[model samples]
Target: MHIPDGFLDAKTWITTTAAGAGAVAYSLRQAKLALEPKRVPLIALVGAFVFAAQMINFPIAGATSGHFLGGTMVSILFGPWIGALVMTAVLLVQAVVYQDGGITALGANVLCTGFIGCFVGYGSYMLGMKLFRGKGRAIVAWMSAWLSIVAASAGVAVLLAASGTFNLATALTAMVGWHMLIGIGEGMITMLVTGYLMERNAVMTGGGFKNERLSRNRA
Candidate 1:
């Protein structure tokens, strides 16, 4: 949900810009500490994938379209800090090169889709994993992906209301309504891709079922 220029008022954009800047800075620091050298390439690849995925918007109801938001997927593989950074990079490139999102509204877009999406998705995934004792990881991932989209849509609605573009209740209803459908696509894609990638990695890293059983027997 990229906010075009003139959608957000000056005050709203300014406030969001400052907040986004601070959040990005903090996330950078955290990423520096948490990021591994081997993960750099993975992060870059995921960021590029997210950027490309966002370019293809599927039509929803009411002439609006929705694209995949990859915050949840990245956060599940990496962490929230790196996830936010990757999202911010995607937003920056989209705004600068493609002009998909407005330059003036860049901060609002980052706050809503980058930070909010990553944190909400990651937190929900963590909570779901805990509640299910990690047995239903695919289900948890799907739920996280779906919830992230809804949460980001709600953030955008709030910003639109704050900018006086529309009433808060109406904005919420419309944005959330369309996004609920969009989130299904997001959930399915996240579940499939994450499961595949994670499983492949487990096999490559000798953490698959056979390896694990062998190791346990040796112990």
Candidate 2:
């Protein structure tokens, strides 16, 4: 969900701004430390896709909108730090160029949608994978994506309540309720895309090894 300007009050935005900045800074370091050279292109591609997917959002509340957030998919394919960075970049561009989200509320949006979504979704997916002993990958991805959106909405709801936009219950009911429905469709999309990519990668990897062995035998 993208929060427009004026959605958050001064104190709330300021606090979230500092927190978001810190999160982005930390993410930069982590991503750099764990960066894989080949995955850079994939990161850019996923970032572009996420940016495009988020453009088609529907207004949910007074100032916010609901859309497909690619946090879970990114984290699953790459890592949480890269996912956070990708989301932050997407939010920054949308705020600056498109004005889809507000500059004033950028920090809150980043905190809620960028950092919170990635970390929560990634953690949930990892936990599911562990519990299932790495079985049901598609199911785990779908569930994690669904949970990520809901959790991100809950973060937005809390901020809305803090900003006095609405009381806690009202904000939660409105934001989380709308997003819960949105999450279902978005989650399925995330699942399908992630599963296809994973399956394709596996095939390509296996085929490469097989070809390499054949070449060596021929040589």
Candidate 3:
């Protein structure tokens, strides 16, 4: 979800920029810890794939279009930190080279779609796995992805409301309403990609508590 320039007031943009900067910094450190040598090239490839996929926006209800967010897919394959990093790179490329998202609102976009999206999806997946004892991994992945998109849209709604662009109630209704529909597409793509990529053995191995290897294993 790209916030166009002028949608947010100066104060909102400044505050979000600071928050986004902090999130990016913390995520970078987490990425370093999560990184594996063999995964670097795959991470780059995922980044490229995300970048390409985002370009083809599918028509949604009304004239608006929605695209694959890719946060859950990346996080499932790598980790949340790497997913965030990859999303950041994708947003950067879209803003600078493709001019799809505005430059001034780049930080806000990253905050909503990159930071919040990645963490929410990945965190929910982990929590669901724990709660379900990893039995319905695919279902968990779908729900995680669906919820993440909705949450990210809520974040955007709050930010826009904070900017005084719209009342909180109205913004929440509009943003959440549209994104709920959009998130169906996100859930489908995330579930398919994650299911296709995850090893059958890895799915079974998730029951082992203290299995740090599962965390490190790339899909």
Candidate 4:
């Protein structure tokens, strides 16, 4: 969900930019450690796939077209940090060349869709994996994506409230309500794509998958 430039005021834009910068910096450092040589190509391909998938949008409840956010899917396949980085890149390109999103509102979009979405989805998936002893992967995936979308919507709601675009109650109700419906779409896409694309042997590093290239790190 990319917020247009005029949607957020200057103060909200500045605040979100600072937060997005910090998150992107942290994610970059973590990505350097998490990604292995063999995994680089795969990660790039997955990012491209996510980018492409996002272009195909279906109509939602309020005449707004919702598409695959792909944050949860990426985070589950890779990790939160890498997933964040990938989304940031996607958003950057969309803003710069494609004009899908606004440059001034880029930071807000990144904070909501990139950082919030990736971390929430990945964190919940890891927790679910632990809770279920890794049995119900599909369920965990679905839930994680569902939660991530809602969380991102919440982030947007908070920002809108802060910007005085709407009162907290109204913004919260509108954003969360729309996203609850949107999240069903998100969950379905995340589960289906994750099941189809993420290979079992794909290395998961720097989040919860400790088995990933431990020897390489030592070396």
- Report the number of the highest-lDDT candidate: 1
Residue clash pairs of candidate 1: none
Off by over 4 Å in 2: 58-65, 200-219
Against the reference, the lDDT scores of all candidates come to 0.87, 0.85, 0.86, 0.86
lDDT digits (tens) for residues 1-219 of candidate 3 = 888888899998888888888889998998887788998887898888888777778889999988889998898889888898899889888889878777778889989999889989999998998799778988899999998899999999999999998899999999989988888888888888888877755344444555755545544
Q: Per-residue CA lDDT of candidate 2, range 26-101, in tens?
A: 9999888767788888889989999888777766555856679888888887878888999999999989998878
Stretches of candidate 3 above 4 Å error? Answer: 202-209, 213-219
Candidate 1 ranges beyond 4 A from true positions: 200-219
TM-score of each: 0.89, 0.87, 0.92, 0.90
Task: Name the best candidate (by TM-score).
Answer: 3
lDDT of 1 by residue, 35-80 (tens): 7788788888988888888878888777877789899998888888
Candidate 4 regions exceeding 4 Å error are 199-219
Cα error of candidate 4 at position 131, Å = 1.0
lDDT of 3: 0.86
Model 1 root mean square deviation, Cα atoms: 5.5
